[model samples]
Target: MADEATFTQLKDKVVEVRHYIHQHPELSDQEFETTKYITNYLTKLGYRIITPEKLNTGVIAEIGQGKPVVGLRSDIDALPIKEATGLPYASVNDGVMHACGHDFHITSLLGAAEVLAQEKDSLKGTIRLVFQPAEETHVGAQEVDAAGGADGIDAIIGFHNKPDLGVGEIGLLPGGLMAAVDQFKVTFKGIGTHAAMPQFGKDPIIALSGTVNAIQTIVSRNENPQKTAVVSITHIEGGSTWNVLPEEAWFEGTVRTFDGEARKTAKKRFYEIVNGQAASYGVDVEIEWIEGPDVVDNDPQLTKWVVDETSKHLTVVKPEPSNAGEDFAYFSQKIPSVFAFVGSHGNSDWHHSDLRLDDEGLIPGVKWYYYNAKRLLAELGKE
Candidate 1:
């Protein structure tokens, strides 16, 4: 634990950094400036930096040395939402905003780095910090993992801000905390004809509409009743004019599931249903399936350790599982890891343009990151 003066100074710095990041937000896979800012700060702290070749963005830095390396990760990308909070430091990057509280993520992790650096020589084992990019697109963790960012890491930990919980609270769930995410895009092609002459041509809209209804069954009907799953058709685009049927129609959506069997069933049925509907409508169909992050399954032992230890410093609560997808699932798949939900006490939930996060959450966030890293390093060192 840090002294009051030190904690106060660290908290001030965290808020400063958070507001700076909130104002100059960048989108996923395009976080060049964010990466540079993180790299510069870590470099000044005398941490060893690892540059990933496959990824254009993201930063990995480390302090201390020896065995039992503990990894701490934070996503540094913003969403494509326009700011509506009207804060003094609202986003200046026109269509981009850190609506997901990533500004808080980046700041708290950096705060941990600053505090840890002062005691780097006395620390036991290494502490690796990963400032990941493209989490919104669900590719950053895989990219970082492929680039060996998780190499030599014994255990890892991460967190997301929960607007529902009050400040000073932390939510923990041992198994299957977040759902798996998969995406698909379908295109239907048919002859264009006047709306009045429906019999003259095959309508792609009919095929698109049918496919949308069919995919819903993939969750409600195909998936086992005991399991959890969701199939959402986010957007559909087809005709430009009301009178003429469009020659082509396309729709894209996402699938979320917590069970592996449920996830597999959903994908298999999605393809079969889409193709079946297109054939029935006499329209040509094209399908594109993209595999996103898997379910964020927390290691039971690691989660227990985190809760038992952090409860001494912060309030820990058991919360319901989230259907939201997290790319940190990739790291959890490879190493023993625990993902926490820190209370931000925001006015609105994540990804909302009007979301307003209380800055008081920033102090607890910095404490969570700094304390968790120290405790993990200490425990792992014992083994």
Candidate 2:
């Protein structure tokens, strides 16, 4: 409900809040200090805070009353990377960093809340502010949704900071904008042997080595090339000494897919390849599959509403699908939801320690959160 000039006036305050939060970054599911800071700020803005005991971290704040409640969510967790930005507001908590730009996410939400709270009396319906935790681990949204966060909410809107496009440029995608993320860990067990030994014992390194090559075929040979999917092995641990093979070998990785069938096919082929390799090498194998967030499938109606509402304030553009998984998809799975990307024109990619973005980027982000909620209230209240 706040006009452009009103939001612009609060720009300095938003940047200040962002700096403080960035300096004291906290990891997922353990954001006690971050929660306290957000609670204090929201309370100071005259908004009522609801502390759900079910939610370990984060708080839900309410403004206004009546029907057609819309929830605006912001992820409040950081990563395990160390700060290398060397900026004045770099993380004071060593080994914990806001490389994902969650600091901006939190600050922008509060900026929107500050303006919304001032115009609450004239607003048509309620606006719920969700400060979510453990987003990096992809479990926070489920907890929030289960704790009745989406109990009465009709629609939910969320946004992330993206590189390439400058401030005020918003990225929009109608359906399946992000891939479904699944995790896997496989361990191969065999008898240890000397490097020079040819027949002394069974070797797990040979089994795991062959299995890695075989897993690649799941995408190249098994799945449809037309569809989007990727399987990447990120971590591997095997062998203790350079000249000796260890009895155990383990590797973990992630799979990304846009289609449900593709995801299933990839997982099926993955297990088959591991099993075949295990049998051939005469070694025991164990596999663990961890399900992550589903595809970020935006509601057609909600997506259209976001484009219409955002076009009134800034340029709206279409962006390609992203492989990076987002927990916001969990919110979309529960209700009619729209997830957006606000460009920051940063030099480094997300999750990098050298990430850099201008503080001015938070201005448009603030207006986005403010206008999205206010416009949703207006449109939904009419129905």
Candidate 3:
């Protein structure tokens, strides 16, 4: 266990950094100001900073020197949601806020960096601190991977704040932590017709109605009874007037699955149901699939490492698999990675305008990263 006085000192720094980031929120890849703040802070802490050209707003800082480098990651970008928390550190930028708690993630890493820097001389292996950008758009992890962020990295660790969990508790899911996310849009084309004479032209609105209803059957009938998949048609637009039949109707929705086989099967069934229904109505359909993050699968061994280290500082609980998606899945693809969740103690859901995190829960998160890196370095023969 760390000294009480030292822990208090580090916790104070964490709060300072968190509040600073909370007040000034940047969105997605356009995190110029946020990147500058992180770079300067790490440099001041005496770490070797690497700012890759590919990710203009991403920063990777290292402390100590040796093989089997352990990585700690945090996202720096904010979402496009408006803040209604009424906290003094509420987002200063209108229409932008840290609703997902990336503000705390980055600040926690910053605090860990400070502690790691103090013990740099005694450390055996290196710690790579990754300050990522555009996590809301699911582009940061991909960009970091492309920029060689995972090079020579033996194992990676990351965490997100969960509002449903109680403060001082850590949640870990061993196998499939999060689901794969994919989106799609379908456009139905038909002939326009006047309101008085319906038989003269084909009605796309009628075809869309059948398509939506049939799409639901794909989940109920095509998928296995045990397997889970979600297909939601969130948007539908078509006729301009109440009586006139429009020439086209557009529908968009998302798909979530746990495994590769399930993802492939769901996509196949979706297209078949949508296109088949359109053809039956004598209407042509165009379908477009938007790619998203893969499911986040934690390495069993790495999960154990996180659980052990987290237990030292707080109460740890194993959680069920989540349907949500995370870009961190990209890193898990390259190396053994563990993605855990810190308690947020909020009643509202994530990505909501009123989403708020318990500031007190952040200290334990900082300790987890700080101590987890120490344990990982020891295991890798760096300590």
Candidate 4:
């Protein structure tokens, strides 16, 4: 346990920094100001910084020396949500808010970095701090890895803030902590005619509706009943006015699954169903499939170690696997990694404008990052 004075000071600093970041939120791939702020802060802590050449929006810094590199990461992107919290430090930038508690992630990692910096000389191996960007779009981790972010790192640790859990509690799962994400956009093109005349035109909207309903079968009938998969059509648009049938209609949505075979099966069935529906409706069809990150499978051994050590300091829970997509899956694929969920004690869930998080969560969060990295470095040094 941290001393009261050190804990209080760290908590105060995290809150102040979080509020400043919350007010000036930046969207993915456009986190220039956020990058600058993080760079300046890490530089003052006397860490060596590395800015990836492929992108100018993310920051990576390192401290300590010698072998057995360990990484701690935090995402640094905001959503396109308007501020609804109405707090004093609510987003000043319109149409952008830290609805996902990324501000908390950044502050916690920064707090850990501050304490770790003070113990740099005594530390055994290199500790890399990764401030990843464009996570919401699911490409940041890939870009970072391509730029050699995880090149020499032996192991990495990351965490997300879970509103469902309370402060001082964390969620840990060994395999498949989060699902893979995939998206599809389908357009049905048909002849346009007067709405009153049914036979005069083939209605694309009808085809779209039929396709949407049929695609649900991908999960219910086509996919294995025991496996988990989701197909949700979240967006649909067609027609200019009620009087005329539009020439084209389009619908877009996402698919999530844990197993690679399940993901492939769902996508194949989706294409077939949409094409079959289009043929039956006598409409031309075009499908755009956007493949995203794979499942966030935590390293079993590393995760077990996390559960054992973290349980000693905080309340550890075995959380159910999440269907949400995370780009950190890319990093996990490359090296040994453990991703946990730290409790934020919020009433609203992630990506909601009304989301709130207690500052007290930082107490456990910073300690986890600091102590976990320190111990991991020591353990790696032995091997």
Best by TM-score: 3
lDDT tens digits by residue: candidate 2, 253-349: 9999998999999999999999999999999999999999999888898888889988988789898889989999898888889898898879888
Which is better, 2 or 4, measured by TM-score? 2
> Candidate 1 lDDT, tens digit per residue, 1-383?
46557778877778888999999999998999999999999999999997667769999989998988999999999999999999999999999999999998899899889988989998899999999999998889988888888889999999999999999899997989999998899999999999999899989999998888878888778899998999999999999987998899999989999989999999899989988999999999999999889989999988878898779878999988899999999998889999999999999999999998988998888788888888888888988
Question: What residue pairs clash in candidate 1, if any at all?
Answer: none
Cα lDDT tens digits, model 4, 34-130, are 9999999999999999776776688999999978899999999999999899899999999999999999899999999988888888888999999
Once fitted onto the true fold, the runs of candidate 3 whose alpha carbons sit more than 4 angstroms away are none
lDDT (Cα) of model 3: 0.86
lDDT of 1: 0.90
RMSD of each: 2.0, 1.5, 1.5, 1.7
Clash pairs detected, candidate 3: 124-382
What clash pairs does model 2 have? none
Q: Please, what is the whole-model Cα lDDT of each candidate in the order they appear?
A: 0.90, 0.90, 0.86, 0.91
